[model samples]
Target chain A: LAKTTQPISMDSYEGQEVNITCSHNNIATNDYITWYQQFPSQGPRFIIQGYKTKVTNEVASLFIPADRKSSTLSLPRVSLSDTAVYYCLVGAGRGSNDYKLSFGAGTTVTVRA
Target chain B: EAGVAQSPRYKIIEKRQSVAFWCNPISGHATLYWYQQILGQGPKLLIQFQNNGVVDDSQLPKDRFSAERLKGVDSTLKIQPAKLEDSAVYLCASSEPQGGGGNTIYFGEGSWLTVV
Candidate 1:
């Protein structure tokens, strides 16, 4: 399990773009970067995942540098509904049963209306 | 398809009492995990099971906590002589078998427990 460090909290207004960076200096070669969003009273939901470079989906984009020591999650046009705690996890690639997934304190993003 | 299912959405018990939580994973998911989340903190993995076999339980408090997944379908987690610190949300999650590109794990609404 790779330890990850991220901001404790971030503030953003509607229609603004929010970027949260996570540092995993000890990330392994087989590890993948994944981001999850968790709203109050609900479980964390998968937002995006990537091995390297950049990966985009309907909700967000993940940008991983060539070194893969850190990654960024970017959300475009934020709204109040997007307010939640976002977790960044670094774990082995798919099908690796030995991987032990862990979670950090996570970055809480408060989207203001 | 339905998501993970957990029962006893809320539970309140006195210290030294016993409590149990049940979980039903998504229809074909082979991997199941139990996590504990304290207020203002991230979730901690307590146990993980792959098709009724224990995968990882190094974080689980073996003395007071025990879990089992019979028949590899439904699972149960039990806490005996619960302490105040045991008061937290118990979350159940499941993911597909190892392999393929998508190994995304899905979680269920957690079961909130309060130890008085």
Candidate 2:
């Protein structure tokens, strides 16, 4: 499993953009970068995933540099409802039998109204 | 599209007692996982099962914790002689068989356990 490091907490106001970066210097070639959002008393929800470059969805965008050592999650027009813990996970492969997706402490984003 | 289902949403037991949690994964999901989440910490994987076979369980405390996925659909995690430190949320998750790119794992609401 590739270890990931991210900020412990971040603060943002409504209509502002929030960016959280995760460092996975030891990420493997077969690994993919994935992010999840977890609200209190609920399960973590998939936000976005990418192997390289950039990928965007209805929820957020993932930006991975060419080195692949780190990745960033960008959220646009934040609202109070977006306040939650964001987890960055590495080491998920394509069709590989090994399923050891590990999570770190996660970055807690507090969106203020 | 039913998502993962877990029962006994909340449980409280005395130390040295026994408790169990049940989980039913989404339809057609071949992989099931059990995770323990402590307050103010990230969830830790306890076990993973592929269909009806065990895939990974290195983090599981075999002396008192055990989980089984029977018929490749539903699973049960049991803890015997629970200790005070066992107070945490037990989460059940499932994902489809990895085919290409990345597989997305889905989680349930989790079962909260308090060992007094």
Candidate 3:
């Protein structure tokens, strides 16, 4: 399992773009980068995932460099409802059980008016 | 489709008391997992079950915590002689384990346990 490092907390206002980056210096070739969003009292929601390059979804975009050592999660035009903790996970592609996720202290994003 | 289900959204018990939590995975799902989330921390996998068999349980506190998935459907996690450190949200999740597709896990509204 690869360990990830991210910011502990961040503050942003509505309508602004937010980018949270994760560092997994020892990421493996089979490792895929995924981001999850969790709100108070709710289960973590999958936001975006990518193996390399850039993958964009309706909710967020994931950018991974060629080395696959780091990835960034970009949320556009955020709203107050987006206030939550964000976790970055590096694991094997799909259901590869060799890489179990160990979530670190996630980065809590506070979206204010 | 129905999502994963968990019972007893909240539980409060005194130290050394026993408590149990239940989970029902989505229909047709073959893999189930239990996680413990302490306040201000991300969820940690306590155990993973592929159907009725245990896949991984390295993080589970076997001394006081026990879990079973009878018939590979609904499962129960029991904690005997609970301690203050055991106060956390117990989450249940399920996923497909048959093959290639990225099996995004679905989680239930976790059961919160508070040991006084």
Better of 1 and 3 by TM-score: 1
DockQ comparison, 1 vs 2, better candidate? 2
Question: Between which residue pairs do clashes occur in model 3?
Answer: none
Q: Candidate 1: deviation at residue B15, Å?
A: 0.9
DockQ of each: 0.64, 0.74, 0.54
For all predictions, the C-alpha RMSD in Å is: 1.2, 0.9, 1.5
User: What is candidate 2's TM-score against the reference?
Assistant: 0.98
Best by DockQ: 2
Index of the highest-lDDT prediction: 2
How well does model 3 score by local distance difference test? 0.89
lDDT of each candidate versus the true structure:
0.92, 0.93, 0.89
The residue-by-residue lDDT of candidate 3 on B57-113, one tens digit each, is: 999999999999999999999999899999999999987733553456778989999
Which scores greater on lDDT, model 2 or model 3? 2
Clashing pairs in 2: none
List of clashing residue pairs for candidate 1: none
For model 1, how does the per-residue alpha-carbon lDDT over A1-113 read when each residue is reduced to its tens digit? 88999999999999999999999999998888889999999888989888889999999999999999999999999999999999999987667765556999999999888
